[model samples]
Target: MNPAGSLVESLLPLPVLLPLLGAGAALVLAGRPRVQRWVSVGVLVAVVAISAVLVAGAADRPHVLTVGSWPAPIGITLVADQLSTIMLLTSMTVTLLVLLYAIGQGTSDDETRTPVSIFHPTYLVLAAGVANAFLSGDLFNLYVGFEVLLMASYVLLTLGGTRSRVRAGLTYVVVNVVSSLIFLIGIALVYAAVGTLNLAQISERMAAVDPGTQLAIHLVLLTAFGIKAAVFPLSAWLPDSYPTAAAPVTAVFAGLLTKVGVYSIIRTQTLLFPDDPVAEDILMIAALATMVIGALGAIAQDDVKRVLSFTLVSHIGYMIFGVALATPAGVGAAIFYVVHHITVQATLFCVAGLVERVGGSTSTTRLAGLAAASPLLAVLYFVPAINLGGIPPLSGFIGKLGLVEAGVQDGSVLAWFLVGGAVLTSLLTLYAMAKVWVLAFWRPRDQLPVEHPEDAEFNDLDHEDDPDRRFPVMIGAGRAGSGEESYSGAFLGAARTASDDERVPVALPRGMTVATGTLVAVGLALTLVAGPLYSLTDRAAADLTARTPYVTAVFGQTVDERVTR
Candidate 1:
């Protein structure tokens, strides 16, 4: 290997290692919230820088590192190819921004009930897990990555310890536990059939196995990854689970976790069973179902967070559609869409949090006149909402266009059907976004109908009823003079203050706003750099299709040479 290649390989492990080390440092400095925040932010920034370097270095060939100087097949290996490095860089960047938003939330009056001590360490562990999953070169290591992240997520999801959050966290835990068990069983079956768990070795040995056995192993792994990715039938748990957490927690999870599952599917499918028509057909069907059903579900939701959660599920279909087509254009489009969704989805969730902060609830029935009250917040919401809806000249539109073109190029009956389904899904998504805009942003706050009859008596109260006339009399949990302290647990389960006098409006934190705005700009920037980014994804897709660069780099020989040896 060249010296440059060696240097890149040497840096491959830092993305995973630095976070784990930072988590430990955070644990030691648990009592010092400010110091812990600095540690966490510094660690992630370093990871972002490292990932950028890896992306540049691994563009042409993969950089492989064998842990503890062990042989490739016998010990763990980490490989950074174009696809993994791109994902690594994108995920780390988003993670860093979310961390800053979280810090801002903690320092503000609207501090999350979750302790900063626990939040920092758990969050960093989650970052490490994402990095590990992207770079893992073997099946077991990938499984380990999933477990690490899942464990951290369990903590993050139930952070506030509210009954609703605990209930949702339990549901999330059960579903993931079952998925993990299935993945473990699949790993066992693959090892029993092939003799090595190394991904490159398994790819080479898989062809020699019986066709039936190969298909069986492939289905088992796909089922496991599909559940994790929240594809349609397996996705019912997500909407309930995600909306209950804090804004930062929900943002990071929405942006990165499911994408890890998608990344796994892309890696295993292209590397292990690239020629399986059965799997491709199955994925195509699943993609269509996920797209249509998720969008429809979003339309039915009245809550802001729930709507975004549903749309998140809906867009996963686009990526699946791309991968199912099994062509360079198809895979490249899927990769591009993944990057676009991560940025847009996270930004929208952060904006939703800000809405809850200002409006006291995320329910459309409870929120109105936000544009009149805070035009900046309204702009924050509108740009990404339309982007998610696939408006022209945005990253979302570019990605969908690539997928549609690839489908047309294929000219299969199923591919053509998918193209139609994708278009219909986009239109449905636009409707859903518009509905939220009209009801939550455009409607007048004074015209909002009463949501709870039991609290109607409070609606009749005059200014004289209040001892301190600092703000208007409270009308249930929906109306206040300042529009910020009505405190309904309608969506986020925010706590209500004891007295209306204490219900002064809390200003939106500048750090949180900056973080969200930066993410939104990043989403727009994707459109500006679409040409070069798409070219990179195209080259990455070419590498995934050929599968030689990864194997050769890992084993120091081509698959043919290794098999012959």
Candidate 2:
């Protein structure tokens, strides 16, 4: 083995292992908020660094490690290939910044019944779940990883414990539980059919299965992943649930959660049953419907958060379109788009957090004169907003263009229809963003009817009964918003009463600003590095479609022997 490859292989498990360990440490340090901060943030930073090295080295080949030196097919094997490492790095970077933002929001001292503390440990566990799913070389492990992250998210989602947060959280929990149950069923069916849960071994076994059985298994897996990915007809849960969480929670969830499902879909489609035309056809129709329906829903939304949530669902179609083409270039474009969307979407939500803090509202109808009040805020929102709308020269445009090009190459009528849907979706997204800009930023502050600052009803807030009026609220801080004292669902307690000017002013913590600004910079960084990123994804797609590197790494089988099985 190459020395560099071996080094990466040795570090492959750290991204998952370190976070799991750090979560336990966070539990030990629960009483010390400051120490918990250091422990949690330090673990994430280390995980990102490790994941980055693996992504940087992925072109050489995948790094595979069997835990406890157990045999590959029978043991728990973690594989960090180009796709997995890139995802790991992107997710960790976003999460670390979100954690910093959360610390600024003051979740370190989260008061809950557990006393074991929830925020730091739960957040770290969430990171571990994401990493585990990415590295999992077996189907059952992937299912476990999903449950881990989803459960952690359950706590994060209902932090405030208000009627609204709990209601939304319950909805989230029920939907995910059902989705998970369906996913387990698919796993059982696959295992029973193939007698192995190892993905590489399944690949070998699957090739021998009859076409009817393969199609059945493929649809089962897609159905489970589809609900999680929030594909149309299965995505109604997201728009309602996501907008209810605190800003930092919402930002991370919006950016990272659905993409995990997309990643699973990508793995299954590319590695397990690459040639199923039936699934491809279903993906085609679903992609177009998702794009159109999601965009239309965004246009109908009056609240900034809901609009963004709907857009998030809309753009997922573009990724699915790339996957549906089932070509290397097509999947490559999907990969690139996933990276772009993660950063941009999270940045936009962070900006939304800022908007709520500074403007005292995320409702465009209630917002006014933000551009004048905070030029920096406007700029932050503008960049990602346009990037998301696919304006020229941004990463979004580049990714969409790549997908369209791939669709054209495919030359199928369904691909062409999806291409058209993507274009229309982009135009509608731009319009929806423009509507927000005009209402929230450009209008005079006084032009919008001024309600007394103390009135304190959140138009964008779900407006449920907040039984406990928590104090010490930090609006835009992105933690929890106390009931009857909602500060745009970010800070759980009120800090100090705002004066007339301070109430309207864009005063944010330095840590919060720096973290939000860093993410915006990361989005810009993606634009600057688009070329190299595309090249990397292209190589990843090629390697994935060929399916040689992964099998060789895990099963210790040559390509011909593996294919002949």
Top-TM-score structure, candidate number: 2
Cα lDDT tens digits, model 2, 119-158, are: 7788889999999999999999999999999999999888
Give one digit per residue, the lDDT tens place, for model 1 in 1-565: 5898888999999999999999999989876667877899999999999999999999869999999999999989999999999999999999999888776553321233456677889999999999999999999999999999999999988875666677889999999999999999999999999999999999999999999999999999988999999997889999999987878889999999999999999999899999999999999999999999999999999888999999999999999999999998999999999999999999999998787766656777656777766788889999999999999999999999999999999999999989999999999999999998998888865566543432422211112233232221110111132243333323221222223212234556576788889999999999999999999999999999999888888899996785699
Best-matching candidate per lDDT: 1
Model 1 segments beyond 4 Å from truth? 107-112, 450-506, 563-565
- The CA lDDT at 81 in model 1 is 97
lDDT, residue 86, candidate 2: 87
RMSD of each: 5.8, 4.0
Query: Considering summed lDDT, which 10 consecutive residues are worst modelled in model 2?
Result: 488-497
Clashing pairs in 1: none
| Candidate 2 residue pairs that clash | 471-493, 471-494, 472-493, 472-494, 472-495, 473-493, 473-494, 473-495, 480-491, 480-492
Give lDDT per model, in order: 0.85, 0.84
Scored by Cα lDDT, where does model 1 land?
A: 0.85
